[model samples]
Target: MAFSLFILFLIIGVIEIYAFQAVKTFTKVKWVRLCYVIISLMSIVFIVYQFTRFDRSVGQTPMFMITVGLMLLVLIPKLLITSVLILEDGLRLIVGSRNYFNNYDKEASFLPERRRFISKVALGIAAVPFLSLIYGMTVGKYNYKVLRHTLFFDDLPDAFDGFKITQISDIHSGSFDNPEKISYAVDLINEQESDLLLFTGDIVNTNATEMHPWIDTFKKIKNHEFGKYSILGNHDYGEYVEWKSEELKNKNFEDIKDLHRQIDFKLLLNENTKLKKGNDEIALVGVENWGVKFKKVGDLNKASENLKKEDFKILMSHDPSHWDAEINTHEKDFHLTLSGHTHGFQFGIEIPGVIKWSPVEYVYKQWAGLYVNMERYLYVNRGFGFHAYPGRVGIMPEITVLELKKRKKVV
Candidate 1:
């Protein structure tokens, strides 16, 4: 690990040097150049210092999130500049070799000076991500977008033909720095006034206490007519942090589960409830966090033990991967499954209908939005909050409103 880190820093140093050269080539002002170097060095030192102080027992603190954000903010732009400079250098090397071998510029200089135009272009390119990251931190994280989808399912109960369900996931409350934004989001959720509200989890980063401050802020979410329900996400297990003892870890898990109740959301734990509407009903089955790579505590069979395969069912599993792995192909048919663990990687290009893409897609087939297999459907909420880098890019936080329509049989 130490050797790997050493190499990583060595590469960063080289990239920084190349990036500095681009700046130097672009400007002759000494103060501007010196200021850039000083800021870069200070940022690197601060990030390293904060990382060194990170404790396994107290994982993902606000300071640690700042360090990660700062590191990415500084490093990504430099990487872009360095890549452009390296490409220019490669072309220069080929040209210089040809000139030296042919003795073409004997009186003139050995190699031509670096072009100012190239430096200008590199700077322009680097500015894109730099500004985007800044905007992501400041505004994009709180940019809540309500995505609406109408899914038609032949198995949907007639009573729920026009049922509207709102979903938000991956709160990661520990990362929230603004209360007003959260309150506004709750209001936005209330504005929907859906028949039901469901939360697919990651309520806090790691510790249960991370959500303490925002309990009341989230409690503002109004009750839905059909009811409000939630299921745990992988992070809710408190597995990312190192607890002093197993008992403490268990206690934290218990507390995390109670958070849903405090917010008026009935916490579902490998259980199924029947949402009755008049004479008909639909099975709302919720299992614990089940993922392809993360925790696998969810018991689908046990959760749906009382329900038959013919029943109209809506499964709430945190990770979308569970749908790709088991739910879609399970013995019991799940008409609709709701999930939100991917968070669209919190970075992606999503231009609805025209284009939808994210880095997380390579890992999760149903990373975001709706997906269908056979007759079953899964809707993956982008997320409600930020984590790790403490910002979002193209993939804004989401409040999903879905309307279920029963497909009529063709004559």
Candidate 2:
């Protein structure tokens, strides 16, 4: 780990130096150039200092947030500049070689100074991402968007033809920096006036204590007509932290479970419950944290134990990967499954039908939004809170409102 970090720092140092040189050439003021260099170096030093002092058990702190902010500010612009420069260099190599071969002068210099226009253009392009990321950190993180969808299922019970479900996921409460902002989000959910509420995992970052500060605010979530339910996410297990003893870890886990109850959420741990509307009923199954590479304690079969094959079922699993690996292929078809572990990578371009792209797509097949296959559906919420970065970019926090409809048969 030490060696890897050293190499990473070395690479970043090289990129910073290159970017600094470009800035020096562009700026006429000596003091401004010197200030830029100082800020660049200080930001890198602060990041290394913070990482060295970090303790996983304690989770995020104000110092960590500052370090992350500084790191992104410096790295995002530099990375963009580097990409532009590399492209220009590649073009330079081709043009330079062509000139040399055409002239046939063995003594003539092959390399020429880069055009000032090229430097200007590179920096100009870099500014876009630089400013955008800064805006994301300052404002986009707290910007909660409520995404609504109407899903029609042939198996949906007639009584639940128009049932509304407000789904929020990955509320990494530890990363919230503003209480008022969080309260606003809770109020937003209430505004939807959805019949049911569901949260799919990651209620806290590392420990149960993270939710302590936000309990009062979250407890304000408007009571749904039916009820509120939640399932465990990978981070809720407290496995990422280093505990002093097994007993302490177990206690922490229990405390996390209780936090849900305090907030009026019925915690589901590999279990199923019946949501009835008059004489008709649907099965709402919730499993523990289960992922392809994460903790796999979730048992779909056990959760679906007493349910009949024809019953309308909704499964709440933390990671979207679970649907592909287990739920979709299960003998019993789950009409709908909700997840939110990816957080939409917290950064991406999502312009509705035009384009939906995020780096996380390479990692998780079902990163965000809705997916359908063979009469089964999965809705991956974009998360209701931030995590490690303390901010969001193109992918803002989400409050998913889904209405269940029973498809009418043609005469």
Candidate 3:
């Protein structure tokens, strides 16, 4: 990890240096050139200092945000400028080589127009991402969207025919800096007034203490008629942080579980509960944090211990990979599964049916939204809060409203 970080900084330093030279070339004024160089170097130094000294406990603090904002402001533009420069240099190399080979006696002068044009173009192109990232950190992160979908199922119990389930996942409470914003989000969730409110985990980033501040804020979200149910996500395990002892880690885990109880959430860990209306019933199974790469403590068989094969089941597993790995192939078909570990990488473009792309797609096959195969289904929520990146881009915080309806058979 140390070596990898060193290499990353080294590469970044090189890029900053090249970008600084470009600034000098572009700015004809002596004072402006000197000031630009000083600012660039100072930014680099600040980046290194803040990044190395960054404490996750104070992640959402004002100072940390300022540090992150400054880092992105300087680094993203330079990286963009470097990318543009590389492309232009490649084109120049190819053209220059061809000319040199064709004319042995003729003298060739470097294109001053081309150099200046590339520099100007690079700067202009660099500004686009820089501005986009600024927007992402500001308005884009907290921009909440309610995605409503009605799913039809042949085997859905008549009791749940028109049942509504509100799903929110990946609420990394440690990263939430604003209480009013969260309170507003809670109100939004309550506005749906769904029968079942399901939270697919990641309540805290690392330690259970992170949830202490927001407990009162989150308690405002009504549990609805059927009550709120939640399953643990990978981050809820308290494995990412450095603990003084195993006992302390265990305590943190227990505290997090108790936190759920305080918020009126029925925390299910490899368990099944029957949701019934009159004589009709459906099974809601929730498993512990299960991921392909992370912990795989979720025992489907244990969760479905008393469940019958023909029972209409809705499984809640944090990682979407669990659906494809175990739930899909299980003898008893899981009618619907809810997950939200990927958080769509907290970055992606989703235009409904048009284009949905994120770097996380390569890692997790079932990253976000609804995915169906045969009779089984999975709905991956985009997440309720931000994590590592501190902010979201195109993929904003989500509040998913799923209205369940039974499919009518043809005569």
Candidate 4:
């Protein structure tokens, strides 16, 4: 992952250098152009190295060091060009009012044209952030395409009766690093009046330590009479980082598990529980991260142990891939399962009827919203918190309220 990211950034740097040279057509000077390219590339590399902690992730020895060096090489040049253009814009803007066309210098030379040129450059620069804000607020918040659906279930139990479960996935508490926004999400979830609440994995980004500060905020979540339950996401397992030892890693995992106890969420580690509504008893089984690449070791049989042959069932496996890859073809299928690992690639178009595309769709058929396969149903929440990028760019944070309607008699 580190190598891939570094290469991608380096490619970005090279493009920046090429772009600046193209700008040389507008502002010509061999000495100035060379200096700009060199400085800009260097600055970009430096910023990226500092940003990604290339020093700390020194695993592949010299390979890691080389990638970091290359990333810095690529990062600095672009950074420099961007900074210089900003300063040039300020210089042009401070000069008394004049139309940009009138200000254009046709023959004085590249240096003389700097003012109008940089002003245009500045306007372009300013447009990016403003446009980013507009996109993040509007299209980003409302966009998603229902990938594949398991909504047409024939065996959905009336025990849930008319339950609409609003599921959220991968809140990634570590990423929430910010407190205010998390509280706002909690308020929204509570206001939704969802009949049952489900958290389909990744409640925290990683570790019990990350979850400590926001315990009170998460406690505010409201659930329907049927109750709220959760499984674990890949991040929740604390598997990526190195611990003092396996024992220490195991201890850290257990501590985070206990944190779930504090939040009143039942951690379904290949385990089942009865969700009793009146006389109706349906088994809600959840397993710890039963994913393909991650870990598929959890024991579904153990979770299903107490389940009677006649009880209706639902599984909360974090990855939807688990459903099609294994659970869908399993001898016994749960009436419904809930999952949320794909945040719809944090980009897509979801409008009323004509929705389409999220890169996450490539990996997950049930990427967002609902899907129905024969009698089985799975709903993958598009997540409630942002990850990788701190802000959600093209994807809105979701509070999925699922309405679990009962199927009428087959006879």
Candidate 5:
């Protein structure tokens, strides 16, 4: 799907460039004529399909986004030219113009005064969201502080009570070439009064060795009973990277497993543990990363092999997709699931009830914030470390302090 969109953009960009060149060169016939003729037709089809699923051929690729810019470029001139015609025609009907617009002239009446006004307003509506996106990128920072007061389950066992769980996911540790930036993130996490820290996958981008240099600083962070726990993300299994030998790749994964143990983070590896809180106990289950068409390290079968279904399980699964596919399907078995690979696309909004945003929402339904499926809930963190880009534009780095609150039973 991505490649298709890229190629489609490449084609549209070529036509846009050619059209611009033709205008600059003052060609007798605009090169945009033929290309736009096609787009004008496609737009009619696309807009219609958006309203109904009655009939269709698969779906259109979003490369049409690139086409929107091209269309506006051509539409603007047509808009202005036709707008003058409508005004002159109105005057002809009102007073009279020497070169009056006649009902007989089709081109002059192409856009009547009232319809032209409405079309211009429609164009502005289409452009508002794109402009707001730019504004959000500049003014908004993925500020995590707003999350300090969100509702949490308070009756969670003291073994994990006031247990601030600082989570960071999709670290893609190998992508960071800067050590100072990494140190800053480490310092921030360490600064929080977190009882236990959880890293729910994608710890290393392509190799287990990626998290090596930062290990020293990471060890400095406080973790104890509420120590630290981790699970594999889709990228952790080295599936996307090409290796000289499969054995070498497997060995590297093992090394990553041991490394987490060295840092005091027990890699859940499809297993559950009981954290004692006074007279009560809460279960923490960590599964290997598994999600749609990605790595399948999640061993729900193995993870729950020896555990009781009634146990209050807090699962650490990398992808939220896992919750949809496995956890949610297990009835209301697990109380809560913690996941973070989404990074909220490192962009988008999480405002509740006002206006919600995030492209990742179209991918994973529970891409950010909290979600309740039946009784099992999932919290998708926006991650601590940045991937791909070192700077965050909208989505800020996060250190979530989730206080699991429990309500008294209603008889």
Candidate 6:
């Protein structure tokens, strides 16, 4: 552990040195240079101190969120600067070697001095993400976007045609700091007026108490005609934190489930409910968190129960990995599955139709947006709330609206 930390700090020191050189090369002002060094040192010290003081028993406090945001805000730009400087140094090394071997300019120094233009370009390039991170913390986190998709399924019940479902997932209420922003989001959800509302989980970061203050605010999400339903995400189990006792952990888990009720949402645990319209009905099956890398408690068999393969089914699973691992290949043939555990890694570039990319994509095949295979569909909500990083980048918080339509058969 000591050696690992030593290596980590050593690398950080090297990055800081190169980053500082860029600033120094860009300007000769003494105080400006001193200020840069002071700020960098202070940020490193504060980040290290806060990390050391972290208590596993009390996970994801507001202070921790702020520290994470600060660390990213300070470190990312510096890393970009350091990368440019390193590349420049590599070029300088090659050129200097060639010059020495050929005896060109004997009076010249072994290596050329760092270029101001390069420093300027590095700083310019670094500014984009630096400002973006700032915007993500202040504005992007609350920039809720309502994405609408119309899915046509031949198996869809005639009565359920044109049925709309609104989905919000990965609430992570414990990480919330702004009530006004959250209230706005709730209003946005209400504005949709979808027939049904579904929450895909992560209602709290770890402890249920994180949602206490926001209960009433979320309850404002006026009930839907078909109903409001939810399923647990991995974090809802309270497994990320160290509990005083098993009883306490269990209590927290129970309270997390109750949070769904407080918000007037029916919490589903390996259960299924049928939503009927006219004489036809569709099964809404929900299961607990099931992920390739996290907790695995969801039981599709139990959730399906008496439902048959012919029944048009909509599944609620917190992690999209469940669809890849089991749901897609199952004989039951779920028509639609909703999920939101990836949160698009809370960072990535996404341009509708043109391109969609995120680091999380490398980990989960269906990290965000809609995916279809063998006629079954899965829509992964980016997230309704922010976590660990305390903000979002290119991928904004989402409220997914899906409309069901029966596909027209051709002769």
Per-structure clash totals for the candidates? 0, 0, 0, 28, 11, 0
Per-residue lDDT for 87-193 in model 2, tens only?
Answer: 77788788779888888665866756566677787789878877877888889999999999999988788899999999999999888888889888999999999
Whole-model lDDT per candidate? 0.91, 0.88, 0.85, 0.66, 0.64, 0.94
TM-score of 3: 0.92
TM-score of each: 0.98, 0.95, 0.92, 0.72, 0.67, 0.99
Cα RMSD of predicted structure 2: 1.8
**Residue 105 in candidate 2, Cα distance off native in Å:** 8.0
Q: 1-411, model 3: which lDDT tens digit per residue? A: 999989987998789766865675576799988888788888878867877787643334445667777887788789888887777778877777777777743565542224766788788888886777788777777889999999999888887889999999999998888888898899999898799999999998878888899998888887588879998988887777667788988988899888899898999999999998889998999999888899799999999988889999889999999988888899878999999989898777888779999989999998989999996789999999987666787888999999999899999
Model 6 stretches astray by more than 4 angstroms:
none
Q: Is candidate 1 or candidate 5 better by TM-score?
A: 1
Tell me how many residue pairs clash in candidate 3: 0
Best by lDDT: 6
Give lDDT tens digits, candidate 5, residues 132-232: 44443333323334255333453455444444566667766665555665666677777766666788877776667667877786677666556688888
Better of 3 and 4 by TM-score: 3
The count of residue-pair clashes in candidate 5 stands at 11
- Candidate order by TM-score, highest to lowest? 6, 1, 2, 3, 4, 5
What's the lDDT for residue 208 in model 4? Answer: 70
Residues 180-257, candidate 1, lDDT per residue (tens digit)?
899999999999979999999899999989899999999888878989999999999989988999999999999999
lDDT of 3 at 9: 74
Better of 3 and 5 by lDDT: 3
Task: Find the candidate with the highest TM-score and give its number.
Answer: 6
Off by over 4 Å in 4: 1-13, 25-43, 51-130, 133-153, 308-310, 408-411
Clashing pairs in 1: none
Q: TM-score winner between 1 and 2, please give it.
A: 1
